[model samples]
Target: MIHNKYFSEEQIKTRKQQMSSQWDTVLKTNEAVLIHSGEPIQKPGGLDSTYPFLPHPAYFWLTLRRRETEILLYSKDLGWIEFHKEISNEEIFWEGEKNDILISSQGKNINSLENFLENHRFSRIFHLGQAKDASPEAFELKTLLDKTRRKKDASEVSFIRHIAEIANSGYQKITSVLQPGMTERELQIAYESEIFRNGAHTVPYETIVGSGSNSAILHALPSQKIIKENEFVLVDAGADIFDYCVDVTRTFYSSGEMSSQHKDLYSIVLKAYHECVAMSKAGVFWRDVHIHSAKVITEGLLQLGILKGNLSDLIEKEIVSLFYSHGVGHLVGLRVRDTGQEENLNPKTYFGARLRVDLELEENHLITVEPGCYFMPAILESAYQQKKFYDDINWTELKKWYDIGGVRIEDNILIKNDGNENLTNCIAKTEY
Candidate 1:
């Protein structure tokens, strides 16, 4: 069913052609393909209840269908063949009537699995991922698909742009109604309802609404604690539209006015955010961008009397990890953290260890540039005990902002040939 009408028939056709061309380039001799659409799982201890059905990312990338127990077959001779299970009257009674959007787009190549397998034979069957009851050979097709899918096509870009718009709308709605005394869960409801009202059926991930000290915890879940005046509210959320997602994060001041210290920290994070986006372009190494962000954070901390050593020495010593722990950004597309074709560096340092994607930037690549600073008590105490920055640290000044929580500014960007496009730029960085 085309509940969301953002994508058209032409767009779907173009996407299929792109996937076919990309797959043909990577297929080897005597390799036939079988890509499975996964099924829904039952909830533990719930009678006849199941979790929401989500199609495999690769399967959705290929067919744009969310139905379970479907199989896609591909061979050099036969091309694309979709084997979908026929809907029964019992299914229709329970789940309503099925739509023919997928079938009409797939054409006459659709058939039953039994008939498809009986008519065609393959010396070697290679499955994209694990498929039930199939002993198919595993090849490098998964890696190839990941690499090919990194660069979004026009249709994919358009879809993501729509998703960005929805997410931006949600942020706007949440900010307008934000007030002191509201619980974090209430804020989450405000954000999610706005997204759904704007036409997104699902959020890409959990809606993060961290208030006060809770904001210091990365990936903090919504809690019952009431938001107090002058506290920092960090919201990181995304809208999922047709499997494509756009991640965005914005930190807000509950009282609509930032304290001097908070303003300084916010300015530093915003500066690092803009600098990272400016540096994002084809041929530039993502790791270099991350290092530059770290340097900016380190300089900001030094200016605030939090560190006393040379900037370069502090960055080299990974002292910035004491505040900015996660990576500067990551690949954002069909998956929030889209798989990078290359392997991560996995540096031993705290900051470097959090790097999600270490590949070079390329045209058509979609990524998120999020730079954050937090004053987590445990991490600070651990670093202090370990003597990681004992010589360079200024403990007194740091303690003043220890309970300030965190501040993060994130935006989605699409790398282009000439420059890049900021998809989430339409959303404001601050309430003012």
Candidate 2:
């Protein structure tokens, strides 16, 4: 029933109007905007078949229709006008336009764009296209559009929550089937199978299933490498059925009885995750929250004798980044990596630059709060050569736990005025 309502004509129209309403609120008095649904190109080297036509997110959010060469024009004088090409008889014969019944029938022919532009000129034209090949006016409003979309409406929130439930099914399935000598690719297959079985449209990204030492590779592709006993299996994946998608990560230790050392390492990541997520609220600077997450991890490391120094001094020197790389999280919306570029307000340093969003965390803003502690070989080897933190970091202690690989705990968070909601909390972080 929910799936049926998700694709209903009423819901589709409501979403289109939502985009128009947002545009009108942000649009200047004398501005006209053009959102282009990019043209199609065939695959390279004389192939007739084209790559899948994915409409621009801005265009898709507005129209909820995926037609190539479609243009949405907004002007103060004309209100909102959709210039779209009707499905041709030849194309309709091939695939059939079954879903056209839900679309508006009042759109102008796409060919009339030339005349429309000539007659309907405004002070500034905001042209939005693929890869943000947009006019200065459009580029200026990119962050605003991002913010507007980030704050999901009631229905949008429901859709995100529903997809998360399906994703959690996948996570749960992996635990039941987890065993020694199971290949990374096999685990990926098991997880993805459950996601699809639970009614996900598709696995949003290349499913990450890295085990043992390979788990240290953040974006490692699922391979035939065996998931050994007493090591972490890091699975970072999501279920995508609607335009909104959720990015989630869970690290599972293969053995039933995790050693005390491994448990301590994971506890540090969980501690950071809780501290950073607690800071999520309206008007909180995300960068500060991220640094706080690092501080929490640094404190945890100090407790375990991995790093020996004053907490503030270690953080000030960024010795924490040696293990805890990447930001606390980023916005997750239409795209899993749904962060918008903050105009003239980005982190310049090596550590802070990793954070995607610079905006003050706000109500209704849905984001990922993933805190991780990885013992990556490349990063550690380079840091060892640099000899920058010889005293700050206990080299022998760090090497002792190298086999544990990486540990990450991720959950989707919906920000609120006072606090936040954990959207993916239904999925267990640890089984034991």
Candidate 3:
């Protein structure tokens, strides 16, 4: 039931006023701002007449208004500018007025965006689409915002932890309804239905519902595969609420019993997983976290006999590419890849080095510490054949586990003043 007393109009106004103060510096420098209000595209040839709509997460965070064909305007003179589509009879007939619901419910101004901007006369307009390379100042603003979100204010933490609870609930529902003959798509729908039932409006991204050999593909697209005995099920799904997200992954048995091989891999991956988490805190370079995580995975694989190399050689060669391909994790916020500058762990003389943002860890940063070891053929072959160091890898053992698929564990973390909080913990390893 929707609570009529929840977040009263006055409370929202106060919050918006507070946000305006926070955005003051960014506004003072830029004359005009351009932000998009995303309109979801219709599914191709689907029978549903509903036009799907989702506001861009960033736009939602800045304006607190969720409507299509509207733009947010900001300048030094004007406190805040809200723009909406001009309603005409023809337009209203085709698209019933979205203004009444948006304005009344959200307390946003109902003014035409064109008129708002045309009258203000900013010398230049800046939008992400037109940016070849984002201005350094804009990048700095984004980083500051990232830092702000890292430590969840009481309200932000409450929202994220709440989403984690919903995600955990979805996992529980999936387990109860799961059967050997179910298709991946059907299972995906079941899990997502639970998310919606618990008040989550959108999945942070695509739901990964892989079963059987399909589980080996790290970011597997849900397919027609049926769950089978002695096979693994890897699910990576998330929930986005008020532009904050909880990313969680859990792999478990569909048959309520684990195979010997499955248990072995699970144990190895989980051990490395905990090690990665244990090392995270403020002030540690992310590169150190990444490489240390890689070391644990590499050692675990070497012990599994999937890879054969001296410990240093394996770590140096990154021989574990036969198992893992992607970086441990990225920043998570308004965007799954939250806005930030790319920083490096090593000060190496390389081409991408120039692109790296010499960033130092600071308090109150939200980041995802995900570490996975997947065996993908395209990446595996390239690493072994193209790279000199990886040339000595044991191809025989690698190919055996190549069919074993992959394992990825992800969690959204909040860097605190002294330590960190795992916001996605509720959904991690959800056997309850």
* Predicted candidate 1 versus true structure: per-residue lDDT over 227-294, tens digit per residue: 99998999999998656788999999999568998898888898898889999998998888888888
> Lowest lDDT 10-mer window, candidate 2?
344-353
Tell me each candidate's RMSD, in Å, in order: 2.9, 2.7, 4.8
- The clash count of every prediction, one per candidate, is 0, 0, 5
Worst 10 residues of 3 by lDDT: 349-358
Instruction: Give each model's whole-structure lDDT.
Output: 0.79, 0.79, 0.65
Please provide, for model 3 over 268-357, each residue's C-alpha lDDT reduced to its tens digit, 9 standing for 90 to 100: 777777777777777877767666777888888788876676888877766665566556666776556665454233543211112132
* Candidate 3 wrongly placed segments (more than 4 Å): 1-30, 34-51, 86-151, 241-243, 340-361, 377-392, 428-432
Q: Could you tell me how far off, in angstroms, the CA of residue 91 lies in candidate 2 after the best superposition? A: 2.9
Model 2, runs deviating above 4 Å: 1-4, 7-30, 98-105, 121-124, 131-134, 342-345, 350-353, 383-386
- Cα deviation of 87, candidate 3, in Å: 5.1
Number of clashes found in candidate 1 = 0
The predicted structure with the larger TM-score, 2 or 3, is 2
